[model samples]
Target: RVIEITLTSPMPDFLRLLAQPEMGIFLDGSGAGPMVRSDESDGQPLLLTPLPPEARGFPAREQWQSRARQVAVSAMPANSAVDAFAAGEVDLVLNGRLSNLPLADTGPLTRGTIRLDAALGVFGLVVRSDDGFLAEPLNRQALSLAVDRSNLLQPFNVGGWQSTSWIVPRELANGAAAQGERWPNLSFEQRRDIARQRVAAWERAEGEELVLRIGLPDGPGSDTLFTQLAGNFTQVGITAVRAGLREGAELELHDRLARFYSPRWFLNQFHCRLELGLCSEEADDLVEQSIVESDAQLKAQFLATAHNQLIDSEIFIPLGAPVRWSLVRGNITGFEENRWGLHPLFPLSQPPT
Candidate 1:
């Protein structure tokens, strides 16, 4: 059986690179034989091996199966793929870029045809610096407090945009013992006011103004997010400017999908060894302990503690789950909506029973 898949990407080479041995998202001793590639000019075909029913992570009633012996892949721009899909040239097209998202709902497309995976992951800015005005913990907390997360995606108006102020997803956390989000009792106005005072105190002490540079990917969605963020910073008496990713911005957007569902998975992203940002060594220690701490109950305790520590550190500003969407014809089979935002290629080629 031969299956053809169209993947829309600005640089599809990135997909092949990430699937390399020991380089994929998960590091759990699982070797990297699983991959998705197809005949390019080299005439080599990449195949996907379906995981057995018992080997699956996310719960599903259907059994996993593969119907494709050969997979053919075509990579093109988002617009081209959208056009092809709308014209019924392809049965499926997977693309996830806010700038290129086709949400106009025209042609044969409707809300029913579009699939947004409720992907579990991070989608916000990580504070990449520990110097200057951000050196103070109070100021960093204030930065988080000032923004109304719900306003960040007002321009895109995408549905089901879950805004968050916590480190771990509420669903995955053993954080039942803990209280709710930071400054829980405070309103958005009150939080902004407090943030303003904190920035004022810092300026008075240093006798200078405070400026923040945010590095965001190019897109209208990013533009809207930055504008809202800039407004929040302005309210707190701090200057906000857009900077290139390599221009040494204090805050860089960190967007990634979780490979599996676990609070520990979320916390490890901030481990000190990764140097992702200003992370706590104590948090790192807790994560290391959770790895071998046999007792499941105690392990949850350790992970919960580590998550709280990182949340308090405010290294990464929590926005919401990463948004991923795909266009599929109604007859397309096996496009299960999983939290990882990954729709495998082999299963997608299966014929509906």
Candidate 2:
């Protein structure tokens, strides 16, 4: 039977629905449903595909037949969406945060049903370069070293996360820094030792204790991270007070996701000449050079230099990569783990006959 199903929404809603199997759309593979025709939505275009052979036995098959495997996709927030998935009201939860998956392993559901993709984005700390005493590169490096990047993922209850030492994750570089070029290369013990000496020296020179305030957005993730960092900073004799959502705080934690493989997006965020007042002339020069460079190899080289310069300055302390977990049920297939953190919707559907 030829089935024509169309499901679409605004950009975000469309992307979310596109990621779920119930929509009969997959990004990476030819969907189980052969698409006959598609109508463009105001946002992303909608795809029309036939139902999978396996779905012929679905309990709700009757409801979907009216439109030939058509499935209703509603815009749902994170919590409600997850709850619906667990209750079997939905077949999948797309692009869900790992922290929200704790209940996924509860009575009715188990961890096995969850899929995690540690997107190429980074979770890290941002320091104001113009801020007093704390703005010093040595001081910033000490503070950065004091943090235990592993603890950043402790509250998520998921594993397979990696601690990063560079602002851009290696995956974004296409493995160019895989051999340790991007990493700061200091062991935690060595960092801790250096941090202690640096902080003590700074305090000795300034004739005062090294105290700093940390700012973070309001959320469970921020709360957990702040606590962990505060403890780590204490070990190095730096007093870190939770500043709580304050704008322009001396140090702030942040998360940035790359929409595509471009160094500009990552580099622009820290450009000193930008409004953030976090500037480094050398870093800025490299960034400007990289953007204008015509040669592909030279562009990459300039960008890498800029990235390394930023790391040496330690203005941004790389913590851990952001994690995303999804829950999938049924015989649907075609979900592949990707480094870009993208879950293609076209590839998700019933296995081919």
Candidate 3:
């Protein structure tokens, strides 16, 4: 009566041994929250069980149980986990990147098993605000216009993926308001021309070629994206070099934005005091206001203002909404897509009668 399942990385792999295949449940250790070993409140179906020393695999293993089911968890790498799911070795795939799965409409595997969740993350580029060449907002805006986001994301072909201009995805609280943009109707060619002009001005002021290194994390779509970005920057007369992540890389790719919820979490990333990556004093003030204001409407208004200020400043170029996809066996039930991109395991992992 084991219910077997596979989950995304950082969860643990040996989980299959503790719980029977049909009785398996997977919990995201990174996001277990209140469900992490709590024996309070409503009688949640799952039971938190301690794994024996041998069951600890390499270091440790955590398990959960219910009358009908038992779950073991382990960290499985993204590619291997997706491969396992496709091979029918696992009943479910939780939190796999869209770019890593075989999701083309015509692919045999994607007939109806792929699920999309509206995740709360931003995939974008970040430039250090203190860099002399990047300090000007116009230079940043030029970089944003150089790459057409829709074209860049077209290869992924994810259904729920949306091109975003602001760091905060629109579905988040009060994030629906348009955060503003530098140019509205300019064609790619027009935008390129403008970017070239801005770069020329920057070069004349600094007396050096406008060269910048862009660091990107290694992943399925990252290499292609880097090549695409380099081409776009070339068209705009800026020398964009694709590099691995380093401290002084002028521009860098951030595929996963703020992982947790809350508008404050999203806005605080760019504040000067935090020193996360980019920094903005004006945006920092707005974030502080949003944090302290007691009134709900005022809080929303303050966030909207902060978002607009950041967007206007062009510190980040939001590439597209973060990609979150899963592959489930046809018979799996009780699955629901939510904006937060969380799927509680207890209800779904109940053993069949």
> lDDT for model 1, on a 0 to 1 scale?
0.73
lDDT to native, each model: 0.73, 0.67, 0.67
Candidate 3 residue-wise lDDT at 49: 43
The local lDDT score (0 to 100) that residue 222 gets in candidate 2 is: 58
Residue 99 displacement (Å), model 3: 6.0
Best by lDDT: 1
- Model 1 TM-score on a 0 to 1 scale: 0.77
Q: List runs of model 1 lying over 4 Å from the truth.
A: 1-39, 42-71, 102-109, 175-179
After best superposition, candidate 3 residue 173: deviation in angstroms? 8.1
Q: Provide the global lDDT of candidate 3 against the true structure.
A: 0.67
Model 3, C-alpha of 207: deviation from truth (Å): 4.7
Off by over 4 Å in 2: 1-68, 75-77, 98-107, 150-157, 171-178, 181-186, 204-209, 243-248, 262-265, 272-277, 331-334, 344-353
lDDT of 2 by residue, 1-353 (tens): 36565533112234543444456644565445443335556644355455543453445444443334432345567667768877788776777654344545555776777878867676677776445566678878887778777666677666788887777766555334545533357677888999899889878888998788888765455566677888999999988877764465788766655554566567777876665535567978987887667777787788788877777777787777766777877555777666566665445533433
lDDT of 1 by residue, 46-75 (tens): 444445434444454453444333334567
Sort all candidates by TM-score, best to worst.
1, 3, 2
- Error in Å for residue 230 of model 3: 2.0
